[model samples]
Target: MASKKNININLKVWRQKNAKAAGSMESYKLDNVSTDSSFLEMMDQLNEQLVAEKKEPIAFDHDCREGICGMCSMYINGRAHGPDTGITTCQLHMRMFNDGDTIFVEPWRSKAFPVIKDLVVDRSAFDRIQQAGGFVSVNTSGNTIDANTIPVPKADADKAFEAAACIGCGACVATCKNGSAMLFVGAKVSQYALLPQGKVEATERVLNMVRQMDEEGFGNCTNTGACEIECPKGISLENIARMNREYLKASLIK
Candidate 1:
């Protein structure tokens, strides 16, 4: 087999001092990028070069570069989490691009996810939405029963497990024309609504979460399906429909 080739590429990265600071795209040429190197690794190389030149390095959020954290978010080549699908930015490989490719990297653009510095954005809005109601209350003082004793249908349990896989990466919002977050919220709601333990809090959970989502300044889902297409976890659009049903049921309950 032939050896992998290293490529040279250009990058147009967005730089910002802070949320209140004005920002613009700054260009840089990166050389000898190994095809085997992960996108974040190439970013590390760029930072090393910047440091050697006595300039401030780019700042991007990343943890668990293996892709589970879903923290390494970037709008690359006008796509959420880069030019790839079903993976976060950290999981993107340099091999996907050619030697002369000019990659455009920017932070997740949403009113809720304001840019913090360089490629980093403030995604705490998701945390606040989850905090409003992403859990169930269970008795613990000698009254709690073992969850294993409960019988959950395999179909519902599997869907719930799949819905639970959401990592809150904000890719859906970045890829959305309206900067909507219904996909994420819907996944969170579906994970709970599918389980018997979660049924008790279903009405309150959907109401609180949807309410907090709107309060975060995220736009409404217009059903363009962009969120489902760009979601790194492959979260389905059905969750959004399920969320809509849950929300409707909750509204009537109040």
Candidate 2:
């Protein structure tokens, strides 16, 4: 761990006001940064400096500060969530950087996700895709079934849990060269599709979700594997293969 000692660094951040506004990258210099601070904390120090200089502060979205919320979305130095593996941006520490280093930070970039502000893009399109049938439609009746009523294979259960871990952070989208969202959509599909409860509407769920994903203008997946690499939750490409299989089966059956 790096100490709380101060260091100086260079920052290049992308700025955009709204979807209609043309965006560009802007640079700033900072000094006396604590090496032990988290990435967001470093950004806070930069914002404070800009404020003191009467300049518009750089805008970025963050919540919970913990790794759980998946709200800290940043493309740092050409990698989503910085250069760390299996960690969210909030978990990224300034210690990874050296004094006088130049860092480039940007928002999630995808046609489905348009810019809302400087480092904030509209990601509600994912929510809309989810609403388009990302879940099992069975209403919860008062009749509670025992857990043992259905003996799910442990393998299936484990796979379902893995898929369900997707945090919908949009890193997969940003890191993708084509900006495809197969990983995100695939995780949701695999999460429910593997479960018996979701098997009932499996065909409809896969069909509707993929269709909506396409309608959102996200590019097609070419299996570049950038998504799986950048995913903070470490979602697998296997889930995407599962989704591909499910979609094929549904299309053929229907």
Candidate 3:
């Protein structure tokens, strides 16, 4: 095996003391960063350097760095999750940049997701949307039938699983020029709508979720398709179409 080379790079990081404070990009130079290091690990190194100098370290969100938590939200060099495709910020590697490259890191930007601090945005809007109607209300007090007993078409099941892959990372919203959350909401809606267990309250679920999405102040989807392209999970645009259909059916039936 060959030894991976290390590189030096410059970082431009956004810093804000609080939600009410104005923010600006701050520059820092790093030396001998390993190309094998993950982006979050590089960030840790930066923080360590700052602390050694008695300066307040950059604050960024990260947990379950394996990419499942979606807490590591970052806009790197003008792209969500750095220059990688189908990966989150924690999964981005330092090898993507060269020695002399300058990397810019910022938080997810949108009216719905206000900045809580440097590189940390409040994504609770998604939680509120989910709470609105993201589940199937089934009575579990009695004897439950085996999940396999109910027959489901293989196509619908597969699509539902794909939609369920969304991690709620907010990259779709950040990447979209309009900062629309249609892709995220669509995935949440489709995951339920495609399942037989979800059919009972399907109409109400769609209506409530869509209504909550609008109330959160997210921009409307203009169909530019940036959300689908930048999604870390590669959640298909088809889910958006499915959500639209579900919403229309719900609206008419109600």
Model 1 residue 116 lDDT score: 93
Task: Give each model's clash number.
Answer: 0, 0, 0
Model 3 TM-score relative to the real fold = 0.97
Which pairs, if any, clash in model 2? none
Question: In model 2, where do residues sit more than 4 Å from their true spots?
Answer: 1-4, 141-149
Local accuracy of candidate 2 as per-residue lDDT tens digits, 167-248: 8999999999999999999999999899898899899989999999999999999999999998999999999999999999
Q: Estimate each model's TM-score.
A: 0.97, 0.94, 0.97
State candidate 1's TM-score.
0.97
Q: Encode model 1's per-residue lDDT on 30-114: one tens digit a residue.
A: 9998989999999999999999999999999999999899899999999998887899988999988888889999999999999
Give the whole-model CA lDDT for all candidates, comma-separated: 0.93, 0.90, 0.92
In terms of lDDT, which candidate is stronger, 2 or 3?
A: 3
| Lowest-sum lDDT 10-residue window in model 3 | 1-10
Candidate 3 residue-pair clash tally: 0
